[model samples]
Target: MPTDPRLTRLDENRVRVNNPHGIGATLFANKEVPVESGAVTELIEMLALQNTARQFAKAAPGSFDHDPEILRVAVTPDFHKARGIPVGTVLATRGYMVPQAIGNDINCGMRLHTTTLRPDDVTARIDDLETAFRHIFFEGGRDIPMTRGQRHAMFTGGLEKMLSETRRVGEGLWPLVRELGVADQLDRVERRGSLPAGRVFGLSDFMGEEGRLSRDGQIGSIGGGNHFVEIQRVEKVLDGTVAHAWGLKSGTVTVMVHTGSVGIGHLCGGHYRDVVRKLHPQQLKHPDNGIFILPEGDRHRAHAESFWDALHNAANFAYANRMFLAVMAAAGMRQVFGDHVGYDLVYDAPHNFMWKEQIDGEEAILHRKGATPARGFDAMAGTPFAYHGEPVLVPGSMGASSFVMVGQGNNESMASASHGAGRMLSRGESMRGFDDEFRKFMEQFRVVTPTDLRRADVRQRPDILNKKLEQIKQEAPFAYKGIGPVVNTLTEAGIARPVVELVPLMTIKG
Candidate 1:
């Protein structure tokens, strides 16, 4: 096994020690960067295939990737390099922020709903159910109508706005939010479904759009790339008590929705990328640069506030998107079996984006990309699902099994775990290699995409389906690492424990 020279094995779960300028360390309460410092370019030599587990621990404290705002950094077992940083990297920042840390997918997260229905509910009527799902997301079956004020409120106000929208437009939300009891369902949602967003400027212009007067133009849409809505069956309950309390029973059905802030997240990330880049004009000269930071200071106060506003707006929009998508999926199911059982919210949490939390007595800002905060049971005492710990959705690639685990609150993990089986192959690489693998997946699982029965014209043209499949080649199941091993690592690392294992029955994507 290859070992990382930069890190000291604090234990099996922890990778510590680093240079202030090289590979990073965990944030300390005192205002100081922990570990030794080193050179940045020396950190990268390039890899041929999947990244080794020690990639995050390879650099010293002051390595090329170091920043003053970054007090400490840790990588989960799913650690893999991203554009500027790496996925599964957890950074503890004191009075500083990095946009790359959160990436463009503002509030990219997962929402899992436990349904009163079971696998048998749709098994016999699989074709009808698939048709129904296709209609709601792609065909004319999408009936969600958002009023102007409700749209402004949602984008500017986050979940609070959604609450008001529910009152105005939530009457027909029966099979989705109504059956679950909206009040109770909303409580289990992260931060009750909203986070405070910085003020969204020119909100009025975006509101009165002809397509809208509500919901920043893309409310009921599912943007592409690693995003999906899948129907899964809980095949096994790993922790009986936790699964029971969370309404997850063996044979019970679920809808797992994963996506982000859509165009909003990209817009905010793009604006700040240039801003951060310009902040460190000197650093831009470095070959391995692009990473930048924003600290709490008078000089850059406005930039910080505006960035948060944009980031939060995108994040809230994402929360709304996932909620709305669930409604669409439920509507499709209802179309097939009139008056079927409804699904209740289990837990909703974001994997991407930056947030502040008090960890180990220090007010630390965590930039968690491709990581979920696994708050242990104690941190969730007052919450409804507190007994089971925070609900986490770890999705496998298309047509594969996804696992639902609960946070174990490993403070050393910075309260985070893998979002999914980290991508082993890049999109371009997968497009080149996944032909045979994709065929095998098609034979085994009920894979549904927009090119299916949703569009009559596309259905007629055999060529379109083939074209669409090629377009989505990047997300082929073989393109990612094994989901089983990733979950095993989390449990062994003491970051999270599995509650229920979910096997996908049907999947729909862009």
Candidate 2:
């Protein structure tokens, strides 16, 4: 079999793939680690997927058939085929925004917290902490201090609006916020723990729609599928200067929460996606009918505003979701240990989302699916941690050590970094028994999961129990690419610099 001529190795850290159909879709991949043949095929498929976006290009920006709406597509080192398109793929476009590139889970991301507690403090009560986590994960991460109206405001605006609404209606989330001092933690959050808030983005299409203010119950929950809350130890500070700025030190305990907007995100993303599909249903023909582009929209009225508000609404909800979850996790730790075992949110960033950003003089929408923004100091000029650059948290697979890196703000990457070690295998293909190897692998750290209790304590059909166990095994460490190479690629590409190395001391998953 001859090699695909379109795929060319540009350099040790770059693989260039020219679009076969001459749509000018090019894929540049990181070659710091082994680039899998399967991933390359998936990347090619992603280019073909853009066929739908290309057609909708109102005025092409460069040389292309439809006036260049689809500008460039770059594959991150952690690239892998996902639900339909490839994850870790950065799709940049001018004049239009493709919804598929951001994914169904809006603002799905990780929130990292630097704790005052020492690793030894958590280790001393590891068993009790595990029990508390079992409750936290399975019990929907505890009750959030939010009301019906506040929940609606949170989705519409974000944590900032939610807090104000809470005050207007009652004493607000300040009780808990002041008690835990989590409100101040917003300084370290991306966008201050909220999306662009207020009526400045305008009202939603379903303005007076009844039951619109729902989802109060889901405010603090961690939606399933690769989502987790891990208590980790800062094993090493890779960059002393950056680490000092980010307040990271050796032996410090940190909690990382990864999740999305829960039901709200899904509803908003789906509703707007369907709206786009219905605009021209026949035009949605492609690998997944997944490529739909929204042009420079009026965030002030009608369908465009609906789409804009809905996307931001979901993003806002996701920000609050991760914030509420982090607070809940900190509370749980305080309960198991003591109030002195405190933690402060270090950084919160979303991977699965899209935003209109200006690259050079051209305005384009950067869609980051399973990728994090790696903006450098210039991009974060006014921020408190601007000196150290953006905190890009890369979570490793279950039982694997994760990383904390600072974005180098490389423009070639569209200021993005890999979300995690790209999945080497899909969930279905990686399913297997939780045999001796699986047990030993997880035993290294205290992992509290519902399956652990369900398998041993509860009685069920053998087939049913086995099925449950297999689902958990699909997320095993072996299912992912080695984190070492992925992080190395980030640094080598000049997209980011590794700062802190964190090893999981305890993990909780749905």
Candidate 3:
């Protein structure tokens, strides 16, 4: 493929894309254009159009007066085309908040848990483990009962509220919270796994009775579209010092959870998108691109506050949701490995969210969609990760090698890194053809789902079986870019350095 004249190679791993519409963007990849050149093109186009709209909004004469500026834009190695904005894109802006930038799945993130059991220990009972995971994660085995007040607290205060009410909410996974000493593990979580929610919006139906504990379906669900719960074994340790500090050892087992707030996120994202669109100046023509900006100033103070409140509400739910999923996974593991197998949180962080940060000494909102925060030691100061820097969990596609990396804290990239290997092929493209390859790949790896294909009852239902098979094929490893190149890009660019590499033993897709 011919190189685009617009792209200028900044370094071995960084490419600078000059955007004519607004501020140019920095792309982090092994090559200039990256593997998904089409997605890169879309990213540039999206930035260009959004920037054009931003300029028009600023210049257009209207009662809606606010200053909005796009400070810096960075693209991670996993860049891929999405609805309005491309995945793996990060934008830093002043005086404006873009709801589409964060996307619908707010706080859709990664979680890593280091365990005492070894690979051999897990492989010995792989079948039994798969059965347990399917039951716990898919077959209604997860019994997370929460009261109206507990649910309200979770929406309002995140994991912090749950920690505070640990003594009172003693049912279902509540015991695991105390047994696993999750309170002590708060430091391991990003922002201590809590974001203050101004108010709970569009979640009254989910909250149960005040005194009784009730099961909420969304609490422990591993939502679709690349979300998974995997059991992995550490394949190698690159940075021994950091690996030791993070309790990662070769051949040891680990649990990786990838999900978010599910429906709750959609609710908040949709609500805010409409709110921002409605707030757009009545006199000026709305931008052709669906991207709408919410201004942050006295003119729209109430709306600005409402946007943050909604964002925080969804973010808080996501934090607690991931914790519950991790706990549920731990519960399943204990059924097979016994309670002796310890599960310690390595790190938990969001890839899709906005951060209130400083840009060149000015207050700015840093929006990261399908990107991970790679803050360095100084930035991570006062936390346990200060010495080693923030842990950047980059999971590869299904059945591929995942990596744990430490942030280099390069402010040029907005202190961010890629979230994963990224997609080389879209889901529709991946689902077609490659039938023989898909079968071979599945034969080599263990992927447990709600359906037991081996059972006669399931096998008899061809329609159901085919649908399940198609879902798995869409996320097959062939659909994604090579993990090796993506990880190398991070290290080469001084964005992040690998601490350890992990390979999956079993995967659970919902």
Candidate 4:
């Protein structure tokens, strides 16, 4: 086991760290340099693999090679090396794609919705806004009413489709939401924020079953884990060009939702793993890696196609999920702010997943895990925002500030950017470390509390709400790194430029 798991820079071109996974990988350094830190238990395995990867990078393509380009890739220090792979690992290949490279959480992503109200206006109404957000968010509840056509449109063409249809009525309760900038996000989203036409069958049977059983009649709903729906007000705008394109301005209120295909992605990943396991049982000798070797021919082809379709379905689900949340936010704002809080869909996108693209003139599948798509300025060639590029939402956990950035087209990065201030500690870590001070910090930001709702449930049963409110207080801003630094780093790296810094007034998490 690693005695010291900290990452340390050894030199300009090399770094050293005790392997996070104590049993895998062969650690190595250039002969001129030296290994500064490593775990004795697995240094042999780690060094050997590193040498093999380096050699593969220097050599031409060969049979059985898993994307030598992945070997040449570089990652930031915040990215921890994994058991069989590494977070931020990049792969460009024609031979075969590794499912684990993209990951189980398909289409996991972020969405940003803008509002006319500035930070001050939101601050003024924080208490009421928080009450409304709580009902719209964590309660797994909805207060807004939708007609049959709106429901159909939400599932079919999403918000834009609904908006176009609703414009004729002009009496739609949440017209102010149309201004929140959702239309602008359509072109920037993958597949124009629509589900791939041919991949519906790839969706998981489990997810289908669950969706059918869910009380909420929506396919694109936010699920558990780090996923959250936040009402934030833009505190600052760093890049005028990008900010204007994203419809963001200082003091503007925004709603950002982070979630993905949810259980569907998990279902897809689990299904593929079972198929792969059945094909090659030997790989199970080291199952922790989520690594599986696919056999040749039709079997491999089927697995790949099904996986691709599942991915597409999840991406679509995420797109719909964000749209649903945005719609809800619009309705809530209209009731509270009257016609003053106009909302617009600034940008919506998934930062995690795999897609086939031409990078540096090479046709390859780009797998982004905890990374956003940053295809430069010209990347969105066929979309409405093609000239402006895509808007990237980098959230900073539950209670921290979130960043709105525009893609920079860094070719070396396979046109990618970081997803957020990537987790410095696991969820369990936070649960264990949370103290009274942290609890107090979270309480300071919490604007809403269901006194009557909690009492009603509590009167019936002592723990009816299961201490959800109390547990939520642990996820304070202090638990996360400063968003300002993470944004500055991304901007410095030319991966993205910050458009807005949004401070959270109310947050909902599951």
Candidate 5:
């Protein structure tokens, strides 16, 4: 593929895109321009269009003490176009917060768990495990009941609060919580798997009554569009020392979860987007790109506070949501392999969210839409990862290999890394062909969903079966760029280094 003239190769893995309209962006990839050049062009166009929003903020008299500027912009290897902002794009700004940058699914992140169970153990009882996972994750087997106070605590304090409400979880995966010893694994998670929320907006309806165990539909669900729970085996250990420290033994089983705040995040995100739209100056037209900026000043102090609170509230719920999904996965394993199958959390970090950090001696809001933090030794000082770096979970497409990496703290890339193998084809494009490829993939890999293809009832209903097949095609390995090139780019770029490679055993998608 011919490279776009706008993209200038900086190094083997980094490209500088010259945006004529506004601030240019740095693209971290194996090539000067990705094979999917159209996506890169669209991303550049989106970046340039942000200038409209920036200009509006600059022109507002007394709304800001200084002009708001986009401090930095970085694109990850997995960069792809989304509804408004592209996935795998990171933007940093001072004096303003872009709610659209983080998108609807707040704190959509990855969580990895190391287990003592061997690959043989899982393969031996693979069918049984699939049945168990389907029942727990999709069917009515998941019975996590939470009280009103516990719900309040979760939205307010995240995983920390859930640990305190252990006794209240009288049934359903409660045993696995104690067996897994989650409290001891708190430190392994980012920010202790919690973000403080000043208030829980639009969550009162899901709270239920005090002292009563109520099961809500949203908490334990794996949301649609790329979110999944996968069981994998350590295929190779690239960095033996880091691998050993993180408990990743070759051939041992591990569970990788990719999900986020479900309905709650959508509620908060939609609310805030509407709030920003309403807050926009009536005389000025909204940006054609639909990106809105919420400025920081006494004038918008109340809205700013509410924005953070809502963002944190959704983020906290996501942390708890991923935790529960992990536990549910463990519960499935325990049911098939017995209580001897122990598990430990390796790391949990959000790929989509905003962070407050001191940049160039000034406070700035850094938004990572589909990028994960790759803070290095100095940034991770005083933590267990300080000796090495933060754990970066990079999962490939459904059937392909995933990688575990550690941050190098490259500030030029805004200390971030790709969340996954970027999509080379859109969902519609993916579903168009590759019939033989799809069939072969399904035969080789195990994917458990709410509808069992083997069941007579499901097979009889072609509509339901075809819908599921289409969904599967959309996420097939053929749809995404090669994981090899993506991870190699990260290593070559000094962004992050691979620790271990994981091969999928079984996948559960919702």
Candidate 6:
């Protein structure tokens, strides 16, 4: 049988893979399109640059081509012209998987928790809200000044110990929290919502020197990028029943916490990639490009174990990261509402992750790079949200509106959905192109900035793409494929369904 006549090409740095199967794959560059490499110039010349996937396949053709039943490949819009694989390409396979394919930042993601406040409430207390958030969420990252005895209890007793004396804002919040799935999450969450036990051995010692350990506790906290803890209102409820189920109503305000396992996760991911590189060279089926190899002995198993362990650690770090943010946010709300302000965890999940899930009842390692789990079944079988499909939160660019969506249990694309309005341009481009517009957009939000930092912050802060003004030109609200269209695509494709829509009142970027 003539192997599906494989043909490849490069357009600038973008590599295009063409096969009779109609599987046309393109891999992009993280940097801008290159100019004049000096000699050959043609459409085919550009195609010469294989994105990461092609490079991987080229490395170990025997390993990939030998398997017929399982491998599936996908390229997200983030794919750019590049020498290696683009950042967002996704690969799912049964029996074996690659850690680099999923990237080093496992479970690197965004969360958008909502509140019960209305738009009016946001404007009325905007000043107070901003003050509370600045002090509690951003600057309050250090230990909460626990007394010596309290410290002992936290170390010895764990979550229960800390919660017992936590300056919880009010009495009634716990029940509502239970309703939102926080307490239940504590049990069902990986490691019962705790940090991984030991130092990430796989990570390079250099990262250790860079302080990966110090940042572990900060994982549950928000970082820059459009990542934030925003207060939003249900500007529009596309589906009433779903919205109600999500605790979203037009007048109700909510909080959206967007973060992930921070430095620790990146360190873990990088370490695993190194493990793959080391093990690949020893595999029985060597890759064409020498970048990949198919291990025949315990090396394969070792590779798998290393990646899996790193993934678990990173995932737990992310979960703890979000939980801690919730603790801080809950504390601040108690300060103002005194009793009225409240929230229930709609859903806490990560977009960038990998898991061992069954595809057509066959075990497979599914990778969601810049994607979220949009399982169709009500409540993913092993999750707390099993009764309700896991809530999927898709945040828009900074000033743009965000989404509150739910997963449909189908295993399409390995039960995953888009992570966000996927970035069309790199952060570098946004900063260079949309400075003035950003200033205007942020002006509407009332975030007080220091004089020195204001200019520096505006010097092309790509993070502000969520703001309307900066978003206007490049990532303008119009630049991104509309959230409505994406949601519609998900529903049409049976990947996910929209539950509610959230518009930001104020946003904070790292």
Clashing pairs in 2: 60-67, 60-68
lDDT of 4 at 260: 78
lDDT of each: 0.70, 0.72, 0.86, 0.57, 0.87, 0.52
- Candidate ranking under lDDT, highest first, comes to 5, 3, 2, 1, 4, 6
lDDT of 6 by residue, 1-510 (tens): 011133233433234445333433443221232212211122123223233234444455544422322355444323332223343445555545656545555666654455665688668876776667666665643233333333223333334443454444233233434345565445434334343323334434322232112232343356645466666778778778777765678867777776776776677766765665665533334433323322322425555555555666666556646666665666666666665666666666666776666666666666666767666545466665566676677777666777777777644345566666655555556657555666576576544211112356665665552453332334434334345445555555555677777777766544
Model 2 per-residue lDDT at 469:
57
Off by over 4 Å in 2: 1-5, 21-38, 48-54, 57-68, 167-174, 197-215, 281-290, 297-301, 432-436, 451-456, 459-465
lDDT of 3 by residue, 1-510 (tens): 137677777777778887776486888876633445577667766675456446645654332344567888999988888877889999988777889898789999999998999999889998889888889998889988878888888888888886786577767888888899998889889998888877888788878777778897898899998999999999999999999999998888999999998999999998888887887767666776667787776667788888888888888888888888899889988999899889899999999999999888988889999999999999999899988899999999999999999998988889999999988888999988998989999899999888987689998999999999999999999998889888988998899999999999989999
TM-score list, all predictions: 0.85, 0.88, 0.96, 0.75, 0.97, 0.70
For candidate 1, what is the lDDT? 0.70
TM-score of 2: 0.88
- For candidate 2, lDDT tens digit of each residue in 114-188? 888888888889878877766665654464444456656776667777777754332323455666665556777
lDDT of 6 at 22: 41
- Model 4, residue 343: what's the lDDT? 66
Name the better of 1 and 5 by TM-score: 5
In the range 21-90, model 4's lDDT, one tens digit per residue, is: 2312221222222122222222223323333333333332332334423322434322433444554444
| Clashing residue pairs for model 3 | none
Query: Deviation in angstroms for 285 in model 6?
Result: 12
